[model samples]
Target: MERKSSSSMRLPPAVQAAALAAVGGSRLQKEFAWMSWAGTVWRLEGQSGAVYVKRAGDLKDERDRTVWLAGRLPVPEVLGLFGGFGDDWLLTRAARGVPLSDPSLGWEPSRVARRLGEILRDIHALDAAGCPFGERKLGHVLIHGDYCLPNVLVVDGRLSALIDLGLAGLGDPQDDLAAGVWTLQYNFGPGHAREFLDA
Candidate 1:
């Protein structure tokens, strides 16, 4: 299938309005990457701090989940939420530091893999009862749902926050671990599968 660049896509009117309001005087920059789901993200920076605006099809509600998880997890702060016109828009304060995708980090696969493991372990250890959205009997704690290198932020060798919480909720730990490994392989190399698993 052909992939469409985010630069070519436009946000719905309602979503655009919400993003503009959240950004205020911030400068908005379009992030040219396709979401696993039909969505696009824009980065806004200003005196307050950086913020990210995302627009997704209204198939599910990620805004509420992100807001509910704010004090409980290392995730973005929901600056605004808007729904209408068949799209859901979420504006969040940017996670401090760079995503694992930052080449300036110059981290080897092992280091990234180890960090991924550590962060995932911490996430799985959180008290699921504290999650307001509720959970399943999956025998594990909350999951990032979309645990991947790009979705994770690291600052000075420590996990700063998690992004793309649209898919997050309670589930088996293995699911997140598997997805993490898959993303590691995709971003690094096939060998990264073993390296991440070993990490």
Candidate 2:
């Protein structure tokens, strides 16, 4: 039987080539997760830097725009976009930090949480500009919606950038904050619950 249509299908050859064209290079790697649609992320290597491809008409448009608008705040640079009709993709430079699951994380969970709080505040502080990207409006300030350690990138003990922001959008900042607290509680486990919640 055919699978549900709402789910993302792999990009065909022409579609992939068009993405490559849009991003200005051949594909380097693809990022995926169970919660996200397939082929939503494509990484291409170019002489100048890396390019991240995102299919257009993808629901992720909001996050892309938010990150681009909040460029000074902290996010990977969006180079350009391609495709349409839900086939659109974006090209962006790669960030430098390793994932939060890195062994070193055990040494810095609390520090990471605090820094993440500061970064979240910066993103939430953007004044409402007449956004051209057509993203959902932040009733207060834009929130990443999924502000977890895994999504926060750090380098040289500094928060370098944020990724998996397609989930980013307008919402009560508490929604993101609560999730951050819960994620910390869950991942660290047991006795750390209160500490995480307090964060």
Q: What TM-score against the true fold does each predicted structure earn?
A: 0.81, 0.64
Give the C-alpha miss distance for residue 20 in model 1, angstroms. 5.9
Predicted structure with the largest lDDT when compared to the true one: 1
lDDT of each: 0.72, 0.58
- Where in model 2 is the C-alpha error above 4 Å? 1-39, 46-48, 55-60, 104-106, 129-139, 167-170, 190-199
Clashes by residue pair, model 2: 52-92, 54-89, 54-90, 55-88, 56-86, 56-87, 56-88, 56-89, 57-86
Model 2 compared with the native: what TM-score?
0.64
Per-residue alpha-carbon lDDT of model 1 for 50-93, expressed as tens digits?
Answer: 56667776724577777767888878877676676777767777
10 residues in a row with least lDDT, candidate 1: 1-10
Candidate 1 lDDT for residue 188: 83
Please report how far candidate 1 places residue 189 from its true position, in Å. Answer: 1.1
